[model samples]
Target: MTLTDRLVRWRYRLVPDHVLGELLSKRWMDNAIPLIILVAVAAVFGSLIPGFYGPQSLSDLARQWGEFALIVLALTIVMAAGGIDLSVGSTFALGNIVALALIGVAGLPVWAVVVLTMACGAAVGLVNGLLVGYLRLRAFLTTLVTLIIVRAVVDMLLLRYAVAIAASFPDSDLWFWFGDGFVAGIPVSVVVAVAVALILHLVLSRTRPGWQVLAVGGSRRSAHNVGIPVRRVICMTYVVSGTLAAGAGVLFASRLGAAGSDIGLGLEIAALTAAVLGGNSLGGGRSSAAKAVIGSLIVMILVNGLVRLGVTSGANSLLLGLVLLIAVAIDVRWLKNRNKVLAKVYVSPTYADLPPAPGTDDGSPYALNDRLRPVEAIGLGEIDGPEDVILDEDDNIYVGNRTGDIVRFLAPDYSRHEVFAHVGGRPLGMALARDGALLVCIGGMGLYRIGQDRTVERLTDETNRSLFSIIDDSRLRLADDLDIAPDGRVFFSEATVRYEMHEWPVDCLESRGNGRIICYDPNSRTTRTVLRNLVFPNGICMTHDGQSFLFAETWACRVSRYWFDGPRKGQVEPIIPDLPGYPDNINRASDGTYWLALVGMRTPAFDLALRMPGFRRRMARRVAPDEWMFPNINTGCVLRFDETGRVIETFWDRKGDNHPMITSMREHKGHLYIGGISNNRIGRLKLEGADPGWTGWQSYWGRA
Candidate 1:
């Protein structure tokens, strides 16, 4: 190999380009930009302004930020429920005046006054909710009208009670402490804000009401069709928003000990700015309390810094407006293009150097022929993508359909097929247990079994997780095939950990070792990884000795043996290093041999592309998925090999008529039954001079 080629291969392997894709796939990545801005803003202000990070400065900032966070969180909730509340600023002023009037003028207890203040806010919100939700008015216009009405009420109330609230002071220590007191060196208002944020976070993320609110926001018609009580959820969101706004106003009243016209003027703009800047989607359906808190900090720091720098009020407003516009633009554009970005970066291709494929020319041992063309097709056009075929003791043919069903065709006639079991996942490899249960490896689900009475049960869906691995490999992604050992242990192949069953083509593009062999032991009710880092490990078959098993790595185009019980336990030895096509499933033959299915044939051009990882990477990025060159899977053949991996014979469907993509085959009662994942039928070929009474069930577990 050239030095340049070697360096390129090493660079792709060692640098872990796939890590960036994995990180981007995470949901938390949406918060990345806002976090960066917060850090940058804090650093800049800290460096430019004197005593910006000092304890006294922070303490005062905390008091203001905490109160503002509550208001922002209130706005976030309303926005998440697919509604907007323009009345929040007026609601805050009304709450502040009510709290002061109830405490100082009415001589009410501090606790009662707090509750009354929140009630006043709830009353205002109820008016907005009734108009926007039940009356089916536009949220934007309805809330705007409510804003004017609430502002007028607050002005009149202030005019009447402003003098009394300023003259008479409340003697309650708790009321004063609510504003100035500290808990463990943290301001009380800050502590309350944090507590409320946690509760709101849980409510939105973990509770059913929160899910309904988000659902309503995402699409009201869809949410209503799903019976989510859309209008009620929208109504509740406004109520919660008003309550939270009023709660923030209580803190404002306690701290300042006064009520005025400018108490909450233009507060709604600041709250909205923080909500969108912190990564909450303004178009609704996506938001969180933590985002509200982060946004609140950014706006509070910026405005406070500008104010201390002696910036004019008009300039401060203008700057905030610009920031809001930028934030909204980012939110809208990011939401629109996030999935497209993820699709481009998530499929990272890696360098793969496959061995030279063996020749399939005429007269060669792997010669192509039309032998499978003459085979009899069973359940033609009725069965759908039967990936594997098996037979019971009575010659009853069983096949897995793509629609998550195991179909059983009766013996002798093979005319009528019945749904033997509905396992609800795409069943791939199946085996008959000693007690008449059929064990199956479902594609997305893990191991499962169907009893004789047709009751389905899940065996294991997870295995021991790999420590220090970025991806969670414990959960089964694609349990492709399986074979049972003598000791009740079922060994299976998970095709790829990074992709699902539908994304198998994409996994082939990566050509990385993302597959693993897992063993599920019924005795311990435990599943564990026996071997890992194989390239698309597709099929598994236990050897006759019960000490080791053979498995096929499809993308690697090789068969390997691994010891599980003997002295060489956990040791791996390659059996077949090179093949002309991609291998799918390995099954035992009746004549002390094994049958291997090559699901697709290899092409010279594709083989060359595999060695050039950069070329494949460009292809994936520069073209549509359907336009990408994939492995030639539409035409393949089946072959038989001995224990030493010597090719005894081969069968081909060169005309592509009967069974083209042969994924699996089984020897039963003198016939080789073939199945393909892309074919609509199962093919049965009569074998010459083969054992007429051999069955896979009998070979594994002795005949009853």
Candidate 2:
């Protein structure tokens, strides 16, 4: 390789361009924009306003911010349920007046006043809920009416009890503490607000009720069709919103001990501004407590900074209106185009200069031939994608299809077939365990097993995670192939940690090290990574020595050996560094050899594109996925190689009939069975000079 080529390869390898795509794919990325805005606003204010970050100023601001955040949280809940509560401001005023009247006029206990105040707010919310949720009224008009009615009631109550509340002096320690006390150098209101935020966050993210609320918000018709009580969930969201707003009012009243007509006027507009700015979706079903908090901080900081800068309240309101308009525009545009932007950046390509392809002309063992043409098709058009074929002790043929079923063809004739077991998530490579259970590597799921009782159980779906990796690689993404070791540990290959089974071709385009080999110990019930950073690790086969195994890196077009129990444990050595096609499943042959299936052949055009990562990146960006250049997987062949990596022979269907794209093959009882992920039948070829009685089950368990 030239110096320039080596530098380009190293640049792609070290920079980790894929991390940007991975981060963008995450759910938390939605908060990124708001979080950055919050920081920037705080920085600008801190720099401009003297003593803005001082302890005294911050303490005062924290108390006010906490109270405002409570109102925003209330709006967040109602909005998340696909409704809006414009009456929250009036509800806040009502709660404040009630709490004061109970304490001073009625001489009630502080706790009773708190409860009664919240109950009053809940009563108003119940009316709105009944009108909007049950009566199916328009949420916007319903809440707007509630706002006027609740404000009118608050005004009448204030006229009746305003003087008495102002005159009476309550000798309550709890009331005073609620107003002025501090806990751990933080205001009491801020502490309570933080606790409430935590509880609401958990409820929205971790509880069934929270899911129901989101479901109803996303689509009421779909939620009802799925048996969710959509109306009840919506009603409950309004009730929760009212209760939270009242709770915040109690804090405000305790701190200031004042209530008037202007106390909560236009509060809803400010709270709405915070909610949308914090990244909460106005349409619902896409909000979190973190977003409400971020929005609260931005609005409060902006408002307070402007106030300190001698900006008029009228100007402040105008600026807030402008901010809300801008926030709404950004929220709508970002939500609509987020996935489109991610699609453009997510398929990161990397440079891979593979060695020269070996010649497949006549005289070469890798030469094209019609050896597979005479093979007999067992099921023909009756079956679906049987990616891998295996056999049991009784000679019954077992193959996994795309419909998530392990089908069994009865022995002798191979004519009658039945659904052996239904293991979901597209079963890929399968193996016969020594204990007679059928172990399978389901593509999107983890390792699974179908026992003699026909019950399917999951083995392991996760492993130890990489410490510094940006993507969460703990969960198995594509468990492609597996093999059993002598000590009962199962070693499996995960094709790619970055993509799912349907996106396997994208992995080929990138040609990066996103695959790994994992070992699951049955005794300890633990799974760990045995090998890492392989390019599309596909097939795994334990060697005869019982201490080592050979694995095929499909996109790299090579086979390598790894020792797990010998003196060379944890060492990886290349066996076949070059191959003519993308190798797949490796199985033991009856003649002391191994059979490997090349799932697809490499083309000169594609090989040249691999060397030009920039060109591939542009193609992925400019073209649709179906139109992009993909590996030619429609044609492949099965080949036999000895222990020394020497190709003994190959089998191909030159006419492209019977078995054209072979993914796996197994030698059982003098017959070679061929399976392809894209074919509708299983192929059988009679071996003339082989062990007729050697069954894979017997080889592993010794004639149980």
Candidate 3:
């Protein structure tokens, strides 16, 4: 390793928390150049100057600059987004003064003071947000003017009225703990500063708002294109920063027991220095709250150390100014400003390098799985609620089209097609008999059997007795999927016992979870519920042993397995939680494997579903009868799993971008016959390396 890299390595192993360990590295450049340089200067100064780096000296240094570092963190956020908040120093001073006045003069409780101080801070921040976001002004100049006005107001408050009241009320116990208090071990100021850093860091890195902040900073135009709320996010940043600043002010007054003119003195310079030193440039992207704190620590440590070393305060200021100037100049050393701005605008979210969210059967990892080869689209128009695919003895693909058509697509090349059955009223789930006759879940028309002569025969239209809650208007018009047991009995799921297909999300939001997994006995001509209150149960697949079946409860984003024959008979357990997408239909493949069709992805919309349950039920009751409420049907995908529920490979279609919606897929012989609930043409993806080991009847008949 290079000399500088070795230093960074050693520092990271030792004093890593101080500078985030970049000071010891050689390759350290870009945004963090200022911080690295400051650390190097600290090292050089401490080594050359006597008494520097001593424990007591460093502690004092850190304590004095604590407020400055806090201001820097607040300022860094504003500047990083190509905006400025010069009112920060004034706000800082006002916060400290207001907090002291509340506790000492107002004769109120400590909690009340904290709340009022925070509200005051938020009001200041909101004004800033309102001015720049709504009024539209140059951030630097706008904040500069605000700084003057706010400072004048602070001067009037202290020299005005609140200060006199506080001085006269020194005997009051209101300022007892707040003016000088400690809970467990640490100082309250230190705790507040650290808390602010930790929370904002998480909000920016892990939550949706953080993404929006970066997007707005990166490029307002680009942010809008990707659906980031450019104005609201930007405005919210001001609020967060302002609120945090207010909190810090409360701590300052509590610790000091006094508010003075010097409360926010020179805080802007130090905060700006810490931010630039720690990284995050005005180029509008790339800032970390953690690094900003580290930068703040470095400054605090240096000043305290110098003072403990018996260096004069004047000498320390001179040294810090020289070092910070050199540190900031390095930010401009690499690129002209314009290129830097453009780079931030074009970059995607930072964590794009991480793996996709769990259960994302997007086929990205299985792109080399041969079956996922990019091919021409034979053009499938919008198909409807297709729940299953069955290949008859003729090798012809039969798909249960939700629009009441048993659609057929030819083999080898998907060049020919015909209606194999037209059993109206939303034909959804489908199953092929041993003799190749099709059993279908004709929504609202009961399950139907498709005869060889292309005629539809009604099976059981309704259950023997509907549950009291599911009478007449049970909304079984949205039956989802089915699987046949070894005894020829079919088990199916009615996706909702209340709302129709369009309101599935509404059902989840309502937490009714009223769906049921029902059994259809062909001999008795009866349908009965085996499991009820299943929470939007959608997909069903019988196990190889016929003891139980696995079903997908879509709204819960989980898979459920019910084993009826084993020692664990009649019990349900989670097979998997948080499937990458919303599960729709599942069928057993020939090789003891299972294939699942994802109707749509579980995205941000689903998150909103959990919080707005009442809104969902109301919407469910109002939406039109035929409106399909899912996402991006233009693209759909499928997942494969072993008997143990381990994911094997993924097959996906990118819609017009690649192919089209493939809601249901099946492996027949060596080919994957694809069908969509709404696609006009059936997809035929040749499994180039696959063996013809999974034909439905052959496996069931022991003829494979």
Candidate 4:
């Protein structure tokens, strides 16, 4: 192992997983760390230098920082929107020159000069915007060219009228006061810069346009696909940059009382440096205007402290460049490996090791024998990954496929299959409502209803998220299975909040309590959490007595019953615990028993990994996804349990030739329909001596 790897491993071993996980999971930590570093640097400097924090020194720092602060703000806007404005330095100088020319050459009023100068700045921005946005020119190259052209133009203008403008505008008192005047003990420029920062911060964070800018910056192609007017948003950012740059220029002229050619010579680099230091990414789509101000403060402090410490200007430049390089390197690395890093620190809950499974021929109730008689392969190659199978009143079979479609086979022969509805998500457990609408629990989405006409409507996608989540948790992440109660209330199990539906194995690895059971009431049109902090709650089944429902926590290898009626109402109790496999879907059978589909038989290696949380966390990080040791989903069996949770029967495909990884099974009309998440075909088995006329719909609605 590399030295760095060994050190990181050692550090992790020494620290508790929860402490590291919580600290690393916080979103604000990235921004807060830089601010903290800045404070620490300031403390070191303050202790070394006298009067560093005094009012006079502070006032001087604020006064000098105002114009540069405005320039930094401009850079931040353009950078956040995935573009850069290298012409800002030239634009600032041009604005001041325009103001000076309007006042001195045309003899215009101060207000007219200010208005014309700003217009000139906007005109420059318009050119840049058109070139970069409409003409599809590269931002960096186009702005670089504009920077040179504007600077040359400003230089020529200054050369010709240098003597005349300065001589004519000698006694411009209002202009001088605008740059240097104080309002309530603060410089006017400082006040203006601060006000602009606050306003822009609000706009960027709280407004749609600001979000559009970020969206475009994150990915221009994605923004275009989503119809976000990518070009317009990009163009607007340049215009704002130009406008702010002009304001900074006016302040620059006022503060210095001269429109010097070198006034904005290195302002662009300074602004870019400050923005980068403040946590703005060069690649775009991430920034905070408030953090830009903090970055600017850091830059100013660094420069001022170097000067006070008798450091040369050359050394100061070198130090700033070095800091920028280091910060960018760290930021890029963090961005690339954030997920891996998080996985390493994730604190998974410890689980007890499962016992060895009984032999297939042992004759135990949970034994894996050849009880599942495969009769036919329905939709063999046409449908893929039919995780759940169901039946309607006519014995028309329905199965939700992986391609976000609910496929239905006609009754009698079950030969003709067609798409019943396109739910646009991975549909799992489904139930029929009293009004004939098909209620489905869509993975990654929420509960949805398919009308008799096959029109899909979203029922509910949100519940009270845990307050401890780092990201917004209102939206459902993995709504896995659902079952409807007698009173028309729909209960669903959200598999895991930490991982998406496809990343179910990650939940198994984490073994954390990130799952919950939620209920949606049709009359109230609302969804609320009924149980919280479960470990991969997968399948759900309502009881025949209509008093309680059973839910399977896959990672925990247990089934829990939540009673809402009778003496046990408002209580939750474990009905089935410590199973030999990870259960997927549970459904009511025709013979007053529940059929549980064991998705995967647990192995000793995986169970041992579950008990060792530290090993799982490290494995999640160090191992590639394909190489990760997931639950043994390649082989599975079906188990029948009574109301008291006693194992009554077992069914297995020992060789997995016809059906494997059985996730769900439904019993109807003397036939047992079975489906798997990884299998290409649905299996049918003849149930000998079973009720030939019994249907799943009649079992629920009683021949309605």
Give the top-scoring candidate (TM-score): 2
TM-scores of the candidates are 0.93, 0.97, 0.48, 0.83
lDDT of 3 at 624: 48
Which of the predicted structures, 2 or 3, would earn the higher lDDT when compared with the native? 2
lDDT of 3 by residue, 467-555 (tens): 44423433356676777787888888887655566555445444444678878788887777778767678778877887888998875
List, residue by residue over 359-414, the lDDT tens digit for candidate 1.
98987789987778779988999999899888888888888999999999998889
Cα lDDT over the full model 2: 0.90
Q: Cα RMSD to native, each candidate?
A: 2.6, 1.7, 18.5, 5.3
Q: Give the whole-model CA lDDT for all candidates, comma-separated.
A: 0.90, 0.90, 0.65, 0.83
Candidate 4: tens digits of C-alpha lDDT, residues 563-607: 978998879888888788888899888888888999988887887
> How does residue 321 of candidate 4 score in lDDT?
81
Query: Which wins on TM-score, candidate 1 or candidate 2?
Result: 2
**Tens-digit lDDT track of model 2 for 389-506:** 9998888999998898899999989889999999878989998887789999998899998999999999999999999977889999999999999989999999999999999999
For candidate 2, give the lDDT of residue 261: 84
What local lDDT score does residue 440 receive in model 2, on the 0 to 100 scale?
Answer: 96
| TM-score, cand. 2 vs. native | 0.97
